[model samples]
Target: MLQIFSVTFPFFALVLCGYLAARRRMLPLEAIPGLNGFVLFFALPCMLYRFGASTPIAQLLDYSVFLVWMFCGLVMVGFTIAVTLNDRIRWNDASFGALVAAFPNTGFMGVPLLVALLGPLAAAPIIVGMLVDMVITTSLCIALSRLDGADKHGMAVALKNALRGMLTNPMPWAILLGGLASYVQLELPGPVHKTVGLLADAASPVALFTIGAVLARSQILTVESKHAPIPLRDYVPVAVFKLLLHPLLVLLVGVGAVQLGVPLSRFALTVMVLAAALPSASNVSLLAERFGADNGRIARIILVSTAVAFLSFSGAVGLMT
Candidate 1:
């Protein structure tokens, strides 16, 4: 455990530093988006591309890992909505809540951190899980959120918008282009590849720091606003589901699939389980707010899950390793 914490603590501490910086106005809230843009558009995509280019196309699209993670994610989405939905919380809030429960912060946090913990081989499963979350799970949850509206075409419209959003996202495209480059044995010019590597190298620390800044900005906004106190039922259960139950569910289902003769790698299963254990994606709050859902509930769940993940994630790493 001490050895694991030695690895994990610095990552969490970077997060704490960003949180404190934003909280103390050392990093102004307005500047958070610039950080987010740099990481998302410039840094993270390059990192994914670098890893993806090196990884074989087969590993990147490992159907066994992809299917297993996708199935488990759907179950979480449904289970969370079932448990949290009520008269007050309708489809908009409930579905976004389910989203946060099921959608781990894999793109920004998991790709770099899991690879750091489990080595380069871990990138394939982590990317597979990220693809599943971004392509399938996210679209489904967004579509479900539209069920609250009277618009007859709400689901279809939401699904279209979600797919469009995914298309605009550079990460998947980077992975895809990298996979193609890998598949065809293509090489970039020396300078171009070097530039990509430079950006890729900046990804882990910068992305992790950006996560903390975003979370801190959210926390600050949440505290300053005069909204009704969010009930524990609104957030805690979802956070618990994200940090504890989601990973357990992934592990159990992954093990079952292996027992059932699925050609799943134990290493991939371990990666998927850890991916499931990550905190809720911070972007979900923005999604909720945009779609007229309860961003407050989404924010609370994200905050709680991220705060708890330090202990739970390290513990899982300790136990799994």
Candidate 2:
């Protein structure tokens, strides 16, 4: 357990540092976007690209893992939606609720943390999980939200916009370019490669700190303030699904796939499970707000899940190791 803490403490410590800095106004909240821009547009992409470029293309393209992860995620999403609907939650809000329950923070939190925990090879499964989230989970949620009358754009248009957004995201493109380089055996110039290495190296710490700052800005801990408190009944279910059920389903699906002769490594299965065990994506609240859903509820879900994740994630790492 001490060994597990040794491995896991630094990641959450960085987050705590950022949270305290933001909470105490030691770090300007305005600076978070710029830091996030650096991670999303530059540092993270460089890291992923290097990972993709160096790894065998076959390892990078594990379709069975992708399928199983997506299937399990969809099952969770559907279950959430159904439960919310039974409670007479409005469709738009319920769709967003399902999303918050199902989507993991795979990019900012999962990639760097998993790389630190499991090594750079872990990035492959994380990337695959990201793609599944972007292409299938997010698109489905957006489409459902539209069908629920959140947008006048219609379901088809909403889905199209989701796909378009995914395509334009720098992360997927970085992965593709890296895979292409590996496929064609193209070597980057030494200087360029060195520069990318430097940027890639910056990804983990900055991303982790930014996560803390973002959490602080969300002010999720300040339930006694002006914001209305989230109903426990509503929040607990989503939190349970995101932090517990999602990972359990992913593990079961992964193990079943391995039994069926899927070429998934034990390490890859571990990565998938760890990724699923992550907290809900912080941006789901923003999406909830955008779609005119219950943003406060979603924000609270993100906060509770993130706060509780330290124990859950550390346990996952210890169990896997």
RMSD of each: 1.4, 2.3
Q: What Cα-based lDDT does every candidate model obtain?
A: 0.88, 0.82
- lDDT string, candidate 2, 1-321, tens digits: 788778778888888888888888888878877887898899989988998898788877889778888898899889998887744467777888888788898877888788878887888888888878867888788778776565776777777777787887898899889888889988999999999999999987888888788778767434435666556987778888898899889888889888989887898898999899998887676567666677777777887888888998888888877
* lDDT tens readout by residue for model 1, 1-321: 998888888787878888888989999999999999998899999999888889988998789998898898999999999988899999989999999999999887888888889999999898888888888988998888888783467788888889899999998898898888889988899999899999999988988888788888877787788667899978999999999999999999989999999999888989998988889998888788778787777888998999999999999998888
> Global CA lDDT of candidate 1, please?
0.88
Highest lDDT among the candidates is held by which one? 1
Each candidate structure's TM-score, on Cα atoms with residue i matched to residue i, is: 0.97, 0.92
Q: Give the TM-score of candidate 1.
A: 0.97
